[model samples]
Target chain A: MTVTTPRGFRAAGVAAGLKSSGKPDVALVVNDGPSDVAAAVFTTNRCKANPVLWSEQVMADRSARAVVLNSGGANCYTGPAGFQTTHASAELVAQQLGFGAIDVVVCSTGLIGETLDRDALNAGIEAAAAKLSADGGVSAAEAIMTTDTHSKQVVREGRGYTIGGMAKGAGMLAPALATMLVVVTTDAAIDAETADRALRTATRETFDRLDSDGCMSTNDTVLLMCSGASGETPDADEFTSLLTEACHDLAQQLLRDAEGSEHDIEIQVVNAATEDDALVVGRAIARSNLFKTAVYGKDPNWGRILAAVGTTDAVFEPSALDVAFNGVWICRGGEPGEPRDTVDLSGREVTVTVDLKAGRQSATIWTNDLTHAYVHENSAYST
Target chain B: MTVTTPRGFRAAGVAAGLKSSGKPDVALVVNDGPSDVAAAVFTTNRCKANPVLWSEQVMADRSARAVVLNSGGANCYTGPAGFQTTHASAELVAQQLGFGAIDVVVCSTGLIGETLDRDALNAGIEAAAAKLSADGGVSAAEAIMTTDTHSKQVVREGRGYTIGGMAKGAGMLAPALATMLVVVTTDAAIDAETADRALRTATRETFDRLDSDGCMSTNDTVLLMCSGASGETPDADEFTSLLTEACHDLAQQLLRDAEGSEHDIEIQVVNAATEDDALVVGRAIARSNLFKTAVYGKDPNWGRILAAVGTTDAVFEPSALDVAFNGVWICRGGEPGEPRDTVDLSGREVTVTVDLKAGRQSATIWTNDLTHAYVHENSAYST
Candidate 1:
């Protein structure tokens, strides 16, 4: 149930004194591969982090032998000095592992606009490289966490290969990407193009659909590496399916562990003019503070739901829309239908279904309800 | 000052039994005009309320004699029955004022998807019409409130005329319009075309730029009625300027009285490529929950501001961006500049300035910080 569960992968984590709490903050994962294939996706935010800027060059050839990550400072907007810290850290890892610096990927997460201590980062990377082992995935996961309460990991078995992954994200989650860092490893013999295609497809349906908050981050990266140690060249379709399952599981775990969230909401927009329209409508509802707060109160206020839907440009007649809360149709034909009291909202899991009645396409988005804790956690987070 | 401060206008408010609290829930305003020129704007949300739909038609001919407003129910998504209630209320106001029903406008606010008592609404309209007087504008303003803590009223004296108006909104504020009901009366001798242009211009810079919570509503309406009682044909530009001032005053009042807000934030985007780009950047920062929460905490987290700005497509180099909280530039050249500790945010008013370094165009957006009281208020509001 960890990234190292896949064959030909070794990882390590170390406490580098970068974090004030003396917790582990540096991680390294290396691929001992017969076939070295890699693919990655970075945040689309125009303001790229120093580490992201450095790693984007490493992923240019779609092949990376190692990845080093730290969780003290994001090193974003810290100027040229921050870029040097990232470059030096990667170069130290490459030197320790006897590999070229160009093949090393780097990631950082924490408070933005702060420079990292170069000496501590370099020593941590050297130590991480020396301690890399096949069973070090758990520590690697633990090191990547910033505000996460627990480490998230998943392992899926294919016909003759295995896929494993780890993710860390607590808040600043939105579409396109989130303030998350994910690393997935597979032993399947997949080509670089196929790995890229599968990773994009899986993330688009899973991580890209989770809108914990409407804020995007400047440091988000997801990387996939294939080592082909299982000697099993699984079919591309089957590999994509397993990868998607792994990603979906990790996404759910992230949603459940979102910062200060009480309720996990699944907004399903069905019967839309197009899948894009469904997604647009779902995201609008997910981003509504009013709707999120109502759900937090367990009020079953369907009026807020319709009001959010009305804000979207999705193709749907106002008079023809239908909404349901947890399978109880509270609004039908855009008017009051079943009693709102009939809908139960005491549980942490809630589902809101909207029938657009425009066409046959549909989409689903996951989000968290707004609560006092959410405001509290976010208000004092960086202070 | 209130809507009746202008000559040739009489208004009244009365309890209609529509609100269970038995507060003043109905209001009527009549224009005994030498000219009945009128112009109005409704919520841009596609799912408009019954009153907005009815009033939209009354403004078709660019003329109106009276407007009736209620605060017990939104009459939105209540289907055809809700439309009938709005129509019947307008007719009752017209009958009492001895005018055609088509010349009377209607507006409603409160819970959505619930049917209103038509008989009670009609009786309240009659009572309001009977009690109408030049000094009743305050009562009319009080009647249109939903969750607002106090009534909002403004009066501006022109060279030879006066503009008086009232607005009610506590939450669900966004661009295009908020969940607000506004009635502005002017004794200036202007045609409907000029009135329409001036109103759009005024609202565009004032109310349209006030995004309290980033939630557009279904029952927002702004109406302007010209009585021509002053018989002063003021310069068109001067009238627009005065109108903009009045609207800005009311908008500031609305921002101050926003639901459970502890801080009113002004986001000014300077040196943008265009005014639209400036507005886009300002609105993006205004709608960022992370930025608002940081302000509520008084943390002066300039990184969150930059992260929000990064999400917009406005023309600007990320490395050249600068941000300031209050009067201190904490972030310059995309890096930390002044110490955040030097910035003070203990006051209710806060200003965030962003220099895009793209052009000379700029825009300002007003918003409120997200606070615990905001979550608590909205969570339990509908319940």
Candidate 2:
């Protein structure tokens, strides 16, 4: 299941030599809709990519008919020329689809600050438009991958509507409204208001909970397009749940495929004074290099975990905190508990639970361990 | 020249069996002064070691006769027993020197959340006291090291005054007046107010600017003691300059000897709206994992640098930013300039300069590349 699983959507992917590896690097998704309702979230980073800045304008009217993405270079910090490139790409897509240029959305991901191969991208867009089909979702997903080892696609069916989505991100992942490029399609007869509400809520709980490397990207974008192909309209709450589920499914895939990560960690901060406190504390622990490295070593170093949490301004007694790695409690009341060696962390998934014991609120943050592979991949990413 | 280079000070270091390697793990610095005025700064991290908590009280009175330090275990989060251990260590030093226990400062650094070897430290205190000498600064400096490859010592001689200091920190360095354990002994005839003012000002521009791993240490302590042995009083501004020089010398040494780092990086944020803005932007770039990893790979990834600076709330026009690596302008006015491959990073030191063009203020932050060794050493640190 992928973006095309939803009715009234067509997708295509093509290789135009933008990637040195000669892999598919351009993807196109179109909404053949009775209603072109759309919403998008962009990177909070101030240094917005050219495409990001362009897409912001496209989504300002809350309507779009197409999305074009390429994964070879992030046209960020490329000055005026980069913005013009994005504009030209959108106009080209609009011309091929016989739609208004303002309705075409564009997303780009790869190394930042480099000018994209405009000719390759232009040819790829024409090729993708020519091959557009309802079953091209998988190819579209594959084309958006950079360091991702696999394509991420998900679909959820409600009573009379369906939500489908795809995501591509491996590193420079952190939290906000977005982390990477994600496209969701739905045929639920939702309006722009409903789509915006559902997408924001969905991303906050799913994509925004993953802090893989604590690095924010300039090209992060999440777009939601409603084609309204389903004759029966779904309830707002029901549609939101379906969208959230689809996003969560794709987020899990992204976490699993995160580059150079040996362990996918779930940091649960429980019993915090508030939900924000829980999330903040969880994020702090998730971003700690010391804590991540300890997890990579498969060492139940809960001390590093507590030390990380201690850096947060969360409401908790230093002597009342408890930490557990996997299922073994390694720290209780801020002191040593069970023998650390007794805990097993040989698996790919590790759970670190922290009990602040300050209140009943809780939150969970997903992260990847800092490993040699992580260093290697990031260090040589552009090379 | 080190802590003992200043007149009216005696220092010693001895093996305490606290370290598994059986190296010198305990150090003592005494102020044989007509004036025992002192000042200090502790870790800004909320999760402070017991020794830091104890030393804060010692500095509150603005008078101290000695400072005792032991490396191997950071007595943090060890509950009441940890505080007792710190108190006992200070009392032991005071008893050996025949002074008030309240007049003794204590500093501990090593693995966090573990009970230190109290007996070993006590014995080491006795041994160090017996060996105290005017030429024991080097030994004291060597003893305070945890993962440091060498002792960090510096002495700055001024007109009728001299400032000597020693620092030990190989990792978990960040800002807020302190980053590691530093003891500065000055023969300048300065009062307690002068000592406190000079220490804060010096550290703010020196130790506070070194952000090795963005991990703030729980045991970071910087202490300055004035013995008033150089009977000739020096100008307050002149003594501050000398103290700042000594601190900068030690800070540079810490950067060079940072644990597992391959390159020492200097990030200068120029033309900021304020000094604080410059420091924040510099620190943001310095703490970026993607940027650090790119440095380790010897790749001039200016986009990562801009992306990092974008995360801060600094005042700057995104399109007007300029970034240079190793004196080669790779990005000018937010666009590509010189070829990235033209930059050379074959040396141990690398410099990244960013011109924000927001104002006239500027700041520089020192960091280290994120290498495999850094991840490995930190991963297996406790084990």
Candidate 3:
């Protein structure tokens, strides 16, 4: 169980002939709730998909009872007909679950600018509804994959309630949010306002810091739902922590299963003037192709790191910067500190730490090295 | 002749032991001017190289008589010692040319954070001075190359004066200013103010628009020197146009010889609300990894282009955007217009045109496709 790990939730996944490989490509999650409260975040990109447009309206009131997701066509830039398809899919889910059509959310992933198979989606909705079960979380997780190699799922038990989630994404991963679709469910007693605030805070600290690539997608979305079936009204702070942990787990799984990534890098920025400054600095370094390639070759080229740092406007004296790879300080006080040969990078995970020595603020961004496999996978993805 | 194609200039290149390959690593260009007037532009990156710091001060007085460039070490982020080495190199050139040390400019490239060989540089300056000649421009161009496959040189003749220049840069190229070292010389009769205005205007329209890899360097510099060898003062507009043509010529050479690039892409954005908006939108699309990789694979994926456009805040309606590959209109009014297979990309140069339909302003940016060779070259660059 993933999304259904909590009580008062049911899900189902079914093949829709939407994917060329004949894989399951449609899923539905329903909140069988004592109370229905919902919150969601969408891609900030202006070119949103049709499903995103439909769901943004349903999530406006912070109350959604069901979510329908399909992973074959993005249904973006397909004109008004695509929007109508999304609206009809949500209506189909609402009718089967005995909920208002306005209480249904929708999401789509895969090639943009293509029209979804309306008949296949309609048949898939009926079949998925007929097979809805409390133990269908794993199937639901598997239905939302495009380039991802595996399903991502996580669960965190709180003091009295439980938080669980599933996510799917691979190639176009970056900040503000990973290029992903995520659904989180909880049995904790919470209000709509609390759910909205907690979800925003949790995502900002976790999902928004992973910059696998610097590309933002048109269909990225995350949804959080509350069933309130546990009858345990935990403090909002405690619930937020559990939600953050669950999202973090799912994000890590996405990173590990990212397409063609050989090395995972953590860029930790410390001692900046403010939290925003740290984040800005870390993101700049994380996106540097020269620095990323250096990490791929296991070359401790501290000069490239400093060069990347110099491109940002974050507050820090150039002569006061310090950089370390792993546990060895290769550069200190803006000068060479140790021989670069002393540092070893013969592992899959690399940690680059930068100390700005400006103040007491810090942030960490996760990235991957630029490798031949990455180039090959992305270059040949669409075909 | 490159820099020496114009009158009143002498150049020399010498094999300095600073390079492990025993290639010509030190270069000198002297303005044996009746009127010594100069103007320069430095990298906007805050983390600048030591030589850039020195050249910025020398070009401040607009009267530099000589320039010394070395290519075996970047001499950046090496602390006070690096600055001292740059000062020493300029002083050696001044001493050899019988001028004040403040009248000399300097530049360096190659691996960063490594100390320059002081003994080798001191001896190389003496050798370069002894061999300085009017036909040494080819050697000077070759000496400044790091990973560039060939030398870049150009000459443009106005009605009464001639302008010649050479530039060197390959991988870490972007703008504000292209990350490269450039030196231009002219025999026109011009004042310091006119030289400054002409150089700025020319570069702003040419080199500032080429964004090869979206990585800004810490050591980029462009310099223009004027000598009143031709006693004819041409109109400022004529001089600016000639200089722009010369810079554009050399910038194209850099693009052709860019490291590990298989395809050169020109992104032209037409009909924007303002020039800046056009540039912003063009750059956002040009720097997108998804769009670049698609081009590398020879796939006519217009959806990636629209996704990149959607990430920018530039003025454009999602439903009003149009995109074309080569001459085939693949997307019109934000929907599929023609078959993607109709567009062919079998050549090294590809053009992508976008019509925003918001206003009348336009801009263009040149970039390279993300390829396997780029990944391999950059990954092992410092190792």
- Could you give candidate 2's per-residue lDDT for residues B1-383 as a string of tens digits? 89999899999999999988999999999999988999998887777778888888887889999999988888887888999999999999999999988999999877777788889899999999999999999999999887777888888888887889999886443211123889999888888888899899999999999988777677888999999999968888888888888899988988888766789999998999999999999998888888888899998888888888899999998889999998999999988989988999989999999999999999999999999988877777666
**Which residue window of length 10 is worst by lDDT in model 1 chain B?**
B170-179
- CAPRI grade of model 1: medium
For model 2 chain A, the run of ten residues with the poorest summed lDDT: A170-179
lDDT of 3 by residue, B1-383 (tens): 48999899999989988888898889999999998899998888888989998999998888889889988888888789989989998998998999988989898887787888888988999999999999999999888877777888999888778899999887433221235889999999899999999999888888888888777788888999888788778899999999999998887888877667778899999999999989998888878877887899998788888888998999899888899999798899898888888999889999999999999999998888988877777777667
lDDT, candidate 1, at A237? 86
The order by descending lDDT is 1, 2, 3
DockQ of predictions, in order shown:
0.64, 0.60, 0.64
- Interface RMSDs of the predictions, in order, are 2.8, 3.3, 3.0
Q: What is the C-alpha lDDT of each candidate?
A: 0.89, 0.87, 0.86
Give the residue spans of candidate 1 off by over 4 A. A171-178, B171-178
CA error at residue B249 for candidate 1, angstroms: 0.5
Lowest lDDT 10-residue stretch of candidate 1 chain A: A170-179
Q: Give Cα distance to truth, residue B295, candidate 3, Å.
A: 0.4
- The CA-based lDDT of model 2 is what? 0.87
lDDT of 3 at B16: 89
